[model samples]
Target: MADPPPAPWIGSVAPESVLWPGVRGTQQAAEWHNAPIDFWFLPKYAHLPHPVVPDENIGGMLTQLSATLRQRLDAVPPTPPPRRTRPGERQDNSRLKTYRTRLRPNTQQMEALRKTAGIVRWTYNRAVEYLKAHPNASFHDVREHSVTEDGLPLMNLSWVTPVLYSIREQAFFDAHTALRNGLADVRAGEIPNFELKFRKKRALFSSFRIRTRDWDGGCLKIPNFSLGPGQHQTKIQTGIDVPSLEHDGACIKQENGSWFLLWQKDMGEEKMRVPAARGPEMCAIDPGVRTFATIYDPLRGTAAKFGDGDHKRLFRLDTHLDELISGSTQASAKKKCYRMRRAANRLRARIRHLVDELHWKLRSYLKQSFDTVLLPKFNAHQMSRRGQRRIGRKTVRAMMTWAHGRFRSRLNEAMEVV
Candidate 1:
């Protein structure tokens, strides 16, 4: 049978419009635009009968596309717009294929899903390790050693073997093909030892399977994987507002505790078509040690503060963990250290949660109060300069380890930082 036609392209409103006022007079103004809807080809092997595509293939495709676009821009001249379509040129929806489904997996299914993910991770890492150990070997030769009927270097876990086979049979060849073609241009002598790593957790089973269509008063039926065997199947029907592809939807583990599925209907390619309203006022923010965040709202002409106590609490937790570690006897030290580590982890998680909450609160306030948000483009290395100048060398090193850059970036996005 012939391949399916490309998914329909939908028109979408600009998201940047919501914050346009703050960026109106600045260079950042150029960054805002109507969200463009373009034709994105679904992978040939990603059809329902097929399993999920391999990470390496996806990563290589992205890498190759980036390089190609970069080179194309350098070589091509700017072009003028084409003429508008005549009245008779429009196509009918009758011939189009539109799919909408709600997906949900039970508890046992969630475990199966996790196993599939773990298998993929192991495969990619094993491939990379093989390449490193055998630099002289080509990817094709390495694949021979790395992959089995189920996948290369099989895991100790036995139950998910079928899933592994599905991935290997469906995606392994395509992934290898993409990777080989992508790296073909690299000079043999200049081959980098390191492989490019894609964001793993976000990419796993990113594709969604259609469940029931137009169920639950037009809400897509989504699976609840967290429910156990007795309560395994529950459907969530999110109203017509389709979930964005980039947005992380709720995932519940299935009854078998292996498979996972998206808890909502994916908006898919239609997300870009929605219209965006202009944002509120603009603000300038300074994030630092003395102040978690110092915000200067241009619209209101006022500053706000957040995250003041986080650093102190983090320090206290660290000191306590250190004291616990230092005093524990060697015989019981390992268990004591584990407890301390767990406590420290919990404390750190709490701090992170607080930070996230503060970020959202500040963003919400700014969105309601201002049109734009401005923030210093801070480099953490530069911020650590003071520590290097005044504090001991080791102290400076320690200070540099904190996620100052990450926090600033998160805050900047929240406020639409230019």
Candidate 2:
């Protein structure tokens, strides 16, 4: 291969961005994070080839650069991070909630994600194994030994060492936290044993969490998720066309045969003046199989049914999937199994689309029309079980397939702060 593109960046500029005063353009209609930062270079800095760096914080970077150029042009030093409130004074926090959607990644991107996740899993497993040998070892001890020169063979992290060093640090930090918490629990007699939870590849430990403070434009650059100091942006992260909202971090997972990026998005909306609470003109929702919702307004003494939201579509999609599976068996399956995984993936997409549409419709309608919405708590597992004394196996099967819990969650998400 030709010599790798020269490292476009020299060193992390002091206080981050120093070339902002020259930004003449913002964004081109292009792929989200991979696009170059279009800036107007000053005459003095014209010799520099493509000063644009691979960071998603272009807006914030430019803002900083503008300030830096102002200072330099006026013969003064650059400024630092934004001013904070009275030294130790605290700011009041409002009720915040996270709304998240699955991230869609291409084949190449999915493989890269899988590789990164593998690194975390391997490191975690290796660290646990080493700690077992030296039961008295502390977090610091295990961390130091795992990545050091002499400890090379102990974990063999040559592949992911440099490219994913920060991510590894994050993984170890999480492991340390778990160990510390377990130790504390043992001392306090909270549980009988202090065995730390092992990280598994495909179970409750399937997800790999990441909180990136760096400027790699992949996923962390989305709105409130970016830890860098700058004005919060409203742009989408990578290729996902999601609404702009704040989230703490993202957890990466491979579900079925695809990757998912899960994060909590704040669901609050700008306040529109309400013409009073309307004195408890309340509404109650009763869920049903034939109809998705039955709304009862006691004040008006009226009852109305909302048709089985997406259940029909879900059932239709399920039928299509069954047909696909049955046909796949006829495709030269003597040598090897020939089920079309791609068709199965399409069925999954159909289910996903239906669920999304249902959630959006329910949330918007309830918020816009009702004053007080009362949703009954449900146990879907118990509801789905057809005990020996029970009837309607088909009903139980339908109940199991439908997303009752997700519907309840959407209703809860719609509730405003009291």
Candidate 3:
């Protein structure tokens, strides 16, 4: 069949200026531009057949929408995305594998790590302010303004010492990367352009990168900090044998008051093996607020639903967080602030773990049952923002917590998804 001519300003239009036709509110109609084939209800005026229900039965827009939805539900799934690489190409010996081992740093070593991280936060904030004034300035400009030729510190960093030179240097590099990446995202229309904010110590204090030269056997040497017997060094708690690494490592402090080291090391190549053949079955997944996923198999004439089953616990945690965060205007003790922060962090960690477990289980089920999984483009933001048909605040909260993007990632890992 002869295809219709493409639109004139399709490729050239800026994302913000483009007007989408059928998607009532969101600019997500642009999502269809990347697809090669057409689908149901797109553009709202495609020459598609109507549902079996008579026109007389449809009274309002809601009824018409329900009829259209039924038609869409019965339609065949669209084509799957093209695979990026062959099965075994992802984990070749040439690639580096990252290991996150817990660190058992003593009180002195822990203090030193915290101090270094604080300095990094300070340095990065300074760099952000510098970029605000001189938009074209690079990391070298900040470095020059912050320190002297002989490496003596300048720029309000009275706590800076000669031993912490490496930490300072790495901080500048990180700050530069952050600014560059943020600007790139702005240009790409993924994020709106705005004034950069300082990195707050209260926020998830990002990890500080250190060179991997300190890794010796199962011990990591801490710079600047002194150990009683020798220079500061900490043992990594892991059963696996530590391999020689050639990159930088990051020291991260977890929410539960634990420290860990994220190290990347090259694992040797393995023999390429083809993946097992998948069964000839397909299913459609509809993500909803109440259920984690609603599965429909037209071939088998059956349907199923899955739920996280952690609703009660999650609700309790949410209520606790709300109580802790309320009444921020009044003066509160440091003890109260500490308790609130601890509760919030623990809740965040628990939610993250639960979501991971849920997705993992869904992936296992999809891999076992279906050769192809069909996932609709679900925009929780758009769903919640519907003007007249907007969901309740509680429902919106539950839907947002589903983390649809993470679920898609899990499906991609083990299943053929459309």
Candidate 4:
């Protein structure tokens, strides 16, 4: 309406001048890309307007504005500006903290962990099956049948004898909880129906919790495992310090042929420390599919964008992965299949890594400035529907891959949300 709020950051600034570097420019360009269709066309023409539509004198002005913005965008570097390092301070003060690191488990340890995960899955499925067959059975009945029968412990079961007793118990409890919650949701009319199904052989990742008691100084002691003492301990990625003595528990999981540990801790007396005073007091962010976020600091009348050119890279990776998947399906040899599988995994990881890196960059920006952040009332389903109908399928695909829900959640973690 009102001339689209006079183009956030470009009001009186000459097009020839360099504004804020990478992130800000890329995001502003994203806004420019949508300006014609969203702001001008629908309102003025009531139809999709061509890029160079002939409208009275306004058309020429729009053309010049578009060209100048393009030239400015081309002059700016593609890569986002380097992150400014913060001076040493107590940054991590959350009461509960989670530390994640890539696990470097030797062949023996990997085999052991794999076996332990299998056993856990088996225990979970067994419990669920029992519950389904005996719908009125209590959790105790399910637990007793799963962990023990006739005074014989789970260890007596050949399949469960290899791993620690606690792991199996944890899996059985998890299964019972899931079934109970599902039933509750069905009764509450929150879900149309529920079904208990077994974990398939193929899964995105396999994970099981290791009790604190099971650890022998980094090493997980599994019965009859070949490795002895230190030889079986999974090593964390270099430079990450795991709080050996204070960690509450650990979950080990395998992701795309790589192992990782999610270590948890309770920060007994630590609390959230106030972030140093910097930047603006508050900023309103318009999260988008093409741009990570377009942020406007009303007090300063300045705008900046956060996401680097990650969506483009993600699309390329997605296409490459699709090709790899197609090739893998047609391959007859084991070697080809293995190679394709590895390539696909690498692609998936890269896509995931890019999104995570963008989120962290956003979080860092929030922490360093803007004491209070405001996010629009987002309805993802409605957005998707409107985007597909108005913007086309390609735009809708990007919207879906934006991981907006995850982005919002990470923002919540970083600061107070309004």
Candidate 4 residue spans exceeding 4 A from truth: 1-99, 149-159, 226-239, 244-250, 267-270, 273-280, 297-302, 308-310, 322-346, 386-389
Report the Cα lDDT for residue 203, model 3: 65
- Estimate every model's Cα lDDT from 0 to 1: 0.41, 0.52, 0.57, 0.62
Expressed as tens digits, the lDDT of each residue in 1-418 for candidate 2 is 3544533332332222232222244132111121132311100111221234435575465456445534443453335454322212223223354434566655544555666777777777767677667767776687776544466563465565643454555565566556666777788898777765667654322556655343234343322222222465322234454433243345666655556666544334353223223434455676665556656553343444454343555666777887777776766763333336456656767676666565566667677877556566556676566563253755654554557788777665555312
Global Cα RMSD, each model: 19.7, 24.3, 14.5, 13.8
Candidate 4 local lDDT, 16-75, one digit each (tens)? 123322333323332322223221111111111112224556445545644554454345
How high is each candidate's TM-score?
0.44, 0.54, 0.61, 0.65
Candidate 3 C-alpha error for residue 324, in Å: 1.9
Cα lDDT of model 1 by residue, 1-418, tens digit = 5655632321111322233233243333222222232212110110111112336764565456445544543453445455322122223221222332333434554454455455555555555556556655664565566555433434543533444342432233334433554465354544654343432543323322222221233222323322212345443433233443222223322222123334332333344222111332334555565345655443332334554434555555556655654554333656665555455555555555555565555556655665444455556576457534544544443343345666665544433222
Best candidate (score: lDDT): 4
Question: Which residue pairs clash within candidate 2?
Answer: 20-65, 24-40, 98-264, 98-265, 99-265
Question: What lDDT score goes with residue 388 in model 3?
Answer: 45
Rank order (by TM-score, best first):
4, 3, 2, 1
- What candidate 2 gets wrong by more than 4 Å, as runs, is 1-96, 101-111, 131-136, 147-150, 154-157, 173-206, 215-249, 264-277, 298-303, 309-353, 385-391, 416-418
Better of 1 and 4 by lDDT: 4
Which run of 10 residues does model 1 get worst, by summed lDDT? Answer: 39-48
Candidates 2 and 4 compared by TM-score, better number: 4
> Who wins the TM-score comparison?
4
Model 2 global lDDT (CA atoms, 0 to 1): 0.52
For model 3, residues 1-418, the per-residue Cα lDDT tens digits are: 4655744543332341223222245434421122132321111111111112323432353355445544554466666564322111232323465667666766767776677677777766766777778877865687775433343345344576523565566666666666777777788898988567787786643576666554555554554455222444445444455544466543445445667777766544342111222332555676776667766554353455565244555566667666766732242786667666666667777777776677776688777777557577777777678674357877777777778877886676453222
